[model samples]
Target chain A: MAARGKVYLIGAGPGAQDLITLRGARLLAQADVVLHDALVTDEMLELCPRAEKILVGKRCGQLSTAQQFINKQMIDNALKFPLVVRLKGGDPMLFGRADEELRALEEAGIEVEVVPGITTALAAAAASKQPLTKRGVARSVAFFTSSTAPEHAEHDAIPDTDTLVQYMGGREAIATAERLLAQGRHADTPVVVIENCSRPDQHIRRLTIASLAQGLGAAHGPVLVMLGDAMKTRAHQHNDEAQLPSAVQQLSA
Target chain B: MAARGKVYLIGAGPGAQDLITLRGARLLAQADVVLHDALVTDEMLELCPRAEKILVGKRCGQLSTAQQFINKQMIDNALKFPLVVRLKGGDPMLFGRADEELRALEEAGIEVEVVPGITTALAAAAASKQPLTKRGVARSVAFFTSSTAPEHAEHDAIPDTDTLVQYMGGREAIATAERLLAQGRHADTPVVVIENCSRPDQHIRRLTIASLAQGLGAAHGPVLVMLGDAMKTRAHQHNDEAQLPSAVQQLSA
Candidate 1:
């Protein structure tokens, strides 16, 4: 019997190659066959030059059908390769449909382990020099999404949180804002829209809940919208900041 | 006039040296001085062997006096050193008191920037093969703490969230559970307690809101408690699993 292969579900972090963990980078470098998502960076792929890189990413709107196919391909790869890696955009456990994959791999009698990576909201906070939590101001944070598998997407009530970061929220900002307002979020709640967080081309747009509810123009990069009082400090402070240091300059350069 | 120094507030990540980002590690290596917390690992300090390392951490019960002192020290260091790194335990933006430091640095006309790191909850999820968010099961997640500064610590209401993760929750598990229960969290809500997450000595414990409210034993290491229905799947699945692979053995090795 060929040795039963094990699969590693890895988090690729947000955009930057340097954001990936040393363990994750090491695994990618030595992976027998690596299956990556649509958002995995090319710099990360360069580290895995020796591995067979396969793209199994589901673009927006590609839902359960692609997910089921990815699950099947994962099982097949685990049986053939001693070390198989299924790399996802953020922390595998968060909205990456990892439970389905984990169940499939475990039911097939394959060993599995997950490697965590930095998620995008935190990356957005770092890039903007803001925090998701603050003393006495904003003590808790929520990460949610207005966007879901198209089949399951609906107008769900936005839960109450001190700091709320919504993934894939750009297109639905108007609806999300309406839901939040209906759910009792303050009309003046601070809102920040971050595009391509951590990348050199990242953009930060600040607005109030009312303004965001009115909606804005379309964006090109991956979008995240943060809503809460914790963001108020950043919004107010960014206005007075005039000069960027050499490092930050290079970041936006 | 001598140029003022810049402070880089970098998150060292959840106890693993390798989990620290490439950008974070690079900043550490080049930092003129490094001030790390008690929760920061020694392996992380090794990365900055050439820099002067300062231990300005305040253990549990060490009050706001030390925090004020830390703020003063940070400002003083910025005046002398060209590059000062304030290495925090997790993402500085989350429960890390970064706002006070940012304000102090900015007021003193010194430059500052924050680098994000993987937080403990995400690390715990990765280590336990669980996730902070799921599609139908958990559409939202929250991060909070009961162990605030003594002055700020009170019986505050737990924010309504699908999933909740608490830092320094070991000593306050009973109170936290009671608070959660009072705040409308279900008595049967699943709970997972992770100790010394992402380190070799890490331990994972499972309980329910009711059992957790009854109390658990003290831990020698830092503790994190995760609560949610999203965790229900993992809690059920772990009951029957007994076999450990060689790879897992190496994890304990």
Candidate 2:
């Protein structure tokens, strides 16, 4: 009998197909089957054309694959295939509910390797041409999201760090800004919102905490919110692309 | 005369050569001159062997390149070459003095692009097979370094976040543990120290905050310290590699 196939949990990186690590790209090409997240772009899936593709992520309204079912699929695929790939958007270590999947696979006694990908926060920082940490101005950076796990009760306390990057900052973007403001964060703290980062239609909105608390138009793609004084654009640098309006037209409720 | 060369600030992810982003590798191959940090591995430099390579990073006990001199080198090279690459260890935007270089380049009207790489924190998490953020236990993660800028007066406050990853945790690793313990963090909080993460000689040390406070043998390579409840190894998971002692022999001072 063939030994249980090893599973590779590879990060697809932020939106751009080529942003993935070379190791991730190589493993994807060799995979016998790939179970990917909703945010993994179709272009990324094309990297492994020979492999069977499964979408396990829950889109905004789409019926999402149950965690248990996805775990079962990985185990079942490992039994039948030589290489199994569990592809997640962004680095698998953060906000992806990777702990559950890793625990499930561990119980099954399947060998697994995690290939890191560029997380959205870093990509968002790159897109805005702003470093998340600046010399004396900022020294620490925190990555958090308002989205809570089904089993966990949400906490109101925000992380006290030098810089903040909120993933999945859709409806909660304004709420986050308000809470930070209430926590005495500067109202004029710079905020950079990047939607569909690294994609062809990527859009960047540069505003302030006070302006963000007032409101930001609805976004169609995944949104990442970065707030801190370090995000302030340097004087005399002419970055016109970030000043332009969002390419994705906002739909009214 | 050739148009002024655009500068690309590419991240050489972790310590591994294959960990670099595809975009970074592609640009690196097309570079006419590459100025890289001291931490970038020789294998990564092989990607741009055709291009002139310059070591511009500060190594301990060695005469280091001045920030202004490095900035001037990039500008001078950009004026002569079609493609100039300023390669940095890990992500350029994290602890690297990228802002100074970016400012200098911008002032000279040179086009610059930042390509994100997998930061050492994420790679350390991957090396240890521990997720930085968990559903209920850890909802936020902070990345900081003890090293400060030359001009900045150091502050004593540690970020108040669920999970903390400290870069360049050389002599300060124990000091960080002591500080965290003093700040009311549980002494039993799990800590994972990764030395030369993602490299062939990579080493992982797993212990508690109290144990870390006691002492850790000196590390020759870059050391990253991760501390949080989320770093706890799952009960059923039998990860033996992490249990193994340091791969690199510790030198007694």
Strongest candidate by lDDT: 2
Q: After superposition, how far is residue B250 of candidate 1 from its true place, in Å?
A: 6.8
lDDT of each: 0.80, 0.82
Candidate 2 C-alpha lDDT tens digits along A1-253? 3588878888889977778988888888878999997899988898899899999866644323577788999999998887899999999998877788889888888877777899999888877888999877888899987645423424557788888998888678677887898889999999999898877678888999999987777888999999898899997565645432121111100
Candidate 1: give the clashing pairs. none
lDDT of 2 by residue, B162-184 (tens): 99998887667677887798789
Lowest summed lDDT across 10 adjacent residues in model 1 chain A is found at: A235-244
How much is A51 displaced in model 2, in angstroms? 0.6
lDDT at residue A14 of model 1 (Cα atoms): 82
User: Model 2 — TM-score against the truth?
Assistant: 0.92
Residue pairs with backbone atoms closer than 3 Å in model 2 (clashes): none
**Local lDDT at B147 for model 1:** 40
Worst 10 residues of 2 chain B by lDDT: B244-253
List runs of model 2 lying over 4 Å from the truth: A60-65, A149-154, A240-253, B61-65, B147-155, B240-253
User: What is every candidate's C-alpha DockQ against the true complex, given to 2 decimals?
Assistant: 0.57, 0.48
